[model samples]
Target: MTTDRAMRDTDRMERPAPPAPEPLPRPVLDSHVHLDIVGSDGAGASPEAQVEAARAVGVDRLVQVGIDVESSRWGITVAEKNPAVVATVALHPNDGPRLADLDAALAEISAMAEHERCRGIGETGLDFFRTTGPAELAAQERSFRAHIAIAKRVGKPLVIHDRDAHADVLRVLDDEGAPETVVLHCFSGDADFAAECVRRGYVLSFAGTVTFKNAVGLREAARLTPLTQLLVETDAPFLTPTPHRGAPNASYLIPLTMRALAEVKEVPLADLCDAISATGDRVFGPWP
Candidate 1:
């Protein structure tokens, strides 16, 4: 994807801006976000402003993830600046080929993992949904393996992003001795897949798509999965939840997503929030 020019302007602006409203009072953790994308959206909100908005909405913490090496580094930098934001560094599947030197890339990621603010080792996995070609598939697999190896070596949870490559992803995770904590970020699979993942002790993180009126399949997956294995995410700047659909998303919208999850699970909203928040803390480690 092309870089957003608006983000560059925000980075250059010299004056400090006003603070955002405190996050909402819910016990939620936004497991995925793209702060650079959100900040670049031409909205008045800066990255810091977004965090404040999330706080105002009751989100306790957020995990900002990167899609490429540059963004991975930026994710760490942003996390370092915000007490409520933790970072995950990995080359997203779509950007897998960008890592020309796999070993060096892993080394850089390893260094980032040393930070207290860095919580996990991914946003990495297979994506057969987009490009297709023997060469591209091979490249994606290579990158995915490299990321898994890094997570194994560093002993950090593996945050997976599987899109239209569920079978292959499950196979790889099984082969790789799947990390102790495996989070399927923005899980878009069916109930069977959800059951399999839960059986394997993987966590299924739901995004705003769960709130869509026609998202029967996702809702089923959400309900079928055990609450202890469930988590919620914004995947912000993308997958904005219903009501807020078609607009830019942020961590602040996490409760709406959680409320939807509560509806699917047929539990009270407070119970759902408590379970997800506790699960997130256990998986991601303490909020920095």
Candidate 2:
């Protein structure tokens, strides 16, 4: 099924999340994930289970990303209740076009963004692949620009969701001027695009996709990125890492992605964890 459909499809949730892999040498943070989505999906893992399971396997910190008003509020509630979790609020590019009153919705997003538990503004940016019409694309851009402005005003990291629209994403960021801390979550770019982002000092957060054998370019991007600008995630209930590719994904499985990243970066796992932890602090501020 298409990712757009899957994100909205609760009925066809994948099988339960897989068993956890061996713990990492040191702890690291999941830079982006959807615990709300995971809880609804087949995994049916509670927030407590998801956080503790990841912590057990050295993924102690979690960032629950929001894609709409309802989810954004849910993320704030989740973050308030879980010390291990922080949240980011935004209108997903796909959802932006579907909103009835986008401005009113954004106003709520802006208000939620100021909460102490909310660490950033995004999972925003552009997506050309799913958006076929000019009107939808225009709405996405309008929402993206508004999200960027909100992030800047709030002085929070802008966690971006860029898919198949790298150049335009960069164009808009350049036009609006980016926040001090910008994260390309679930980064889906080639080495060249990665290089451009790196030059601008944006954090490139990788998901389980980098573990795919066919993701040669993504691996190269990982290799090219300095550890200080790098982050990892499961984007759980979606990009399940290798060895457990078909099953549902959760924060507990971060080691699979972290291990793959360590191999690609050719660094000791402990060293990688150290770098990720430091960068996580820089990007999200230490989790409450």
Best by lDDT: 2
Candidate 1 structure lDDT: 0.78
Give the poorly placed runs of model 2, Cα more than 4 Å off.
1-12, 39-44
Deviation from truth (RMSD, Å), model 1: 4.7
> lDDT by residue for model 1 over 1-288, one digit each (tens)?
112223233332322322333333457888888877764342245778777777776887888887767888998888878788888998777766545676677668778866777789888888877666887788788888878887877788899988888899998887777878899999989988898998899999999999999889889999899989999997866677777566666777787887778878999888888888899889886875
lDDT of 1 at 93: 77
Per-model C-alpha lDDT, please? 0.78, 0.88
* Model 1 clash tally, residue pairs: 11
> Judged by lDDT against the true structure, how good is candidate 2?
0.88
TM-score, one value per model:
0.89, 0.95
lDDT tens digits, residue span 1-288, model 2: 015533554533545557779999898999888887674443346788788888888998999999889889999998999999999998899888998999999999999999999999988989888887999999999999999999999999999988888999999999999989999999889999999999999999999999998999999999999989999998877888898777778888899999999999999999999999999988997876
